[model samples]
Target chain A: MTEEIIIAGFGGQGVLSMGKILAYSGIMQDQEVSWMPSYGPEMRGGTANVTVILSDERISSPYLKIVDTAIILNQQSMDKFEESVKPGGVLIYDPNGITAHPTRTDIKIYQIEGTKLASEMGNKKIFNMIILGGYLKVKPVVKLENVIEGLKKSISERYHNLIPLNVEAITMGMNNIVPYKIEKHVFQN
Target chain B: MSELKLMKGNEALAEAAIRAGVDGYFGYPITPQTEIIEYLMTERPELRTGMVVLQAESEIAAINMVYGAASTGKKAMTSSSSPGISLKLEGISYLAGAELPAVIVNVVRGGPGLGTIQPSQADYFQSVKGGGHGDYKLYVLAPASVQEMADFVEDAFDIAFKYLAPVLILSDGLIGQMMEKVILKPQKPRMTNEELIEKNGSWATTGKKGRERNIITSLDLQSEKMEARVHRLMKKYEQMEKEDLRFEKINCDDAEYLIVAYGSSARISQKAVELARAKGIKLGLLRPITLFPFPKQALFELADQVKGILSVELNAGQMVEDVRLSVEFKVPVEHFGRTGGIIHTPEEILEALEQKIIKNGSIRHHKTRKSSIL
Candidate 1:
């Protein structure tokens, strides 16, 4: 099976690292993977996005125009990628700071209050892991164990002690994601 | 032993250089290729393999440093984007003239000058057609994946040393910046001074202890001697065409149309091939691994089999000229691409193939295809 995923958010939101973790998790599972980032000066506090493709066969293109899933975390990304998600695909987003929520009925939508959830968890840095967790809950594309292993590879040795906390955050993400019948567009923030 | 690792193309190239036993790496930072030097510095190959990694004052300084290291029969390399590469071209010409062995990587960005930091293949002409002003050709390799980005370091160094000439890894920022799972080889030991003597004693400045001092220079004032040198360079290029030329053919056996691209464009066209085939169109891809010793002969051979050829690049239309020349204009070879770092999508490629190759191949074919589409 092939899963072409696009992760987009603000630069500080760990969008790239989230894609990296997902890609590494794919590798851990013996899947072929590629990660291509939309990079530039725009990566500095501006909107950033990365396309991560995981496939059983050789992946042809790293960056894709259409994708199976779009994990959007901001309004700019929602505006850009909501239409690009393949019909009957999945879109997961953090409801925080998003003024315009996804409106694509053809694709499934899920929401997680990643920023508020991470704040509740007492670590805002794990916001991306929360989004990732929410995504995994919806699709189960990769396993929790592999994502933990993938995290070990992406984060430095000094952060090894933080894995349990990150894992907790991920579990929180997975547990809290709700399917989008919540016409409640913005976050409860 | 080899191990699988997720790595960006630039970082993989750096790690591969260390694993390849590259003696020294001199470079100036530039996007999106700064990761090469960043990885080198952070990984500290100097501590790991006794390799020297230095950030020179400028691109020119870095290339000249590579020149110095290479002239002494050391495996040396430098990497930069388009503008920085242009800065190094004069030194590159000098390296070619001096017949030094070194690996230069151009992680090209969009440019006629100071262009965008986004990826581009616009440097195709600058690379394969000899960017440096001289009667010389760099042994050029284009890598479509991170694996090849890592593997070609050793291969480029080998070719450079084998021919006592500069070799270039012509990568764009797309391949340089993208990450993929790559199987990395273990570190090999560096060539000992004795081995260097054995391999390059004829000309390398390896301290003339047992033999006469060898002088390395690209300048010989006599016109006939310079002519002979040019002829010798030509012979090396011809030899490269015959021996070192490399390419990959995907689904070409029964293909009615061909997409000829290299590096990232080839990777994109591979998907285009799949898209076209699913739609009942017979399309294939021809990926040139070596841009200088291009897949000219292969394209010429495919010309007889395919109805038309689409030369897809990330530039305006540089390599299409080479493609046309390769097929000798016998087939309708058209160019399709985007410039200023906008990567063409696979669907765009399929559309271009239908509109430019299948439809434009002939008026009758165009009408038939148009009716089918409608």
Candidate 2:
């Protein structure tokens, strides 16, 4: 099985790092994976996105036209990626900066209060981890144990002390994500 | 077995260079490839392996430093992106003319000028056809994966020393920036002065101790002498063409159409091949690993079997020329590409194949082929 996902948001929101950690987790699980980022000037304070693919077999292209999941963290990302997600795939987003919510009926949509939860936990940097937690709770592509091990590898030794707090944020996100229901009658009409 | 670690292609290349016993590295920082030097500096290979790492003031200075170190028969390398590599062309020409063994890496980006910082295969003509002035050739290797990026450094050095010519690791920004698992090789010890003398005693200037002084220069003013030297260089290149051409052929046994690409383009074409096959189109992919000693024979043989060929690239149409030349009109060959750093997707390539090549039904004509060949 292969899971091709795009995680996009503002530059400082740890979008790239979150994908990196997930890719590392895939490696720890003895799976083939690839992490490709949209580099250059777009990564500087603008919208940044990464394509992360985890597969049981070798990954063909690191770039994809359509993905299994779209983890949108901002309104621009939502507007850009809503149509790119495969039908029946998942779209996870943080309701913080998004005014225009995803209105697609063919796919499942879920929202996590990532920014609010992170701010409430006294650390805004854990926002990405919270979203990641919500993703894992919905898909369960990788185990939580491997995610912690991945965190240990991606985070430096000096920042190891913050692992517990990040884990707490993830747990809270996994429990708090709410399903985004679209009225079927309106779409059918 | 070496342990597998997830690393960016640039970082893997840096680590592999150290483990491959590179005696020195001199490079100027360039985007997409800057991580190579950054990782080397952070690792501080000098402390562990006695290797020297220096950031030159400019790309010109960097390639010249590589030339200097290589003159002493040391394993040396320099890396930069397309624009920065343009600055080192003069030094590259000098190294090729002098027959010095060195590794030069170009993590290419879009360009005819200082184009976008996005990935591109536009350097194919420049790298494989010799960017610098002179009738010279550098063995060019295009790596598609982070693993190959790490593995090819050692291979490039080995081939460079064996042929006494410069070897280029021609990669692009996508491969340089992507992260994947790599199995690093065991560290090899740097050669001592005595070992260097023993290996390159005839050509290298190793202190000239109790022997005739060895001189290295590419400036033979005598017309006949220079012609003779050019013949010798051409002979070496011919040998490489015969013996060192490397490529991979996927799903070609019963394939009706062939897609040719290298480096990142090849990776994407592989997906296109699969997509076409799923649609029952009987498509396959042929990836040339060595761009210079280009697997021309393999392509020619495949062309005989396949109904048509499509050359997909990240440039306007560079490698397509080589593909056309290799097929020699035995089959219809078409080109599909995206320029200015925009990478084409598999779906796009597949669409192009269906619209341009497959549906066209082999528009066989000798007139255009004759004109192109001439």
The DockQ leader among the candidates is: 2
- Candidate 1 regions with alpha-carbon error over 4 angstroms: A182-189, B364-374
Chain B TM-score by candidate, in order shown: 0.96, 0.97
Give one digit per residue, the lDDT tens place, for model 1 in A1-189: 999999998999999999999999998899999999988787557999999999999999886788999999899999999987999999988888888777767888888999998898888899998888889999888899999899999999998999999898888988999999646458786
| Colliding residue pairs in candidate 2 | none
**lDDT (10s digit) by residue, model 2, range B124-232:** 9899898999999989999999999999999999999999999999999999999999999999999998899999988987889799998888999999999998999
Clashing residue pairs, candidate 1?
A: none
**Candidate 1 CAPRI grade:** medium
The weakest ten consecutive residues by lDDT in model 2 chain A span A180-189
Write down the TM-score of every candidate.
0.96, 0.97
- Top-TM-score candidate index: 2
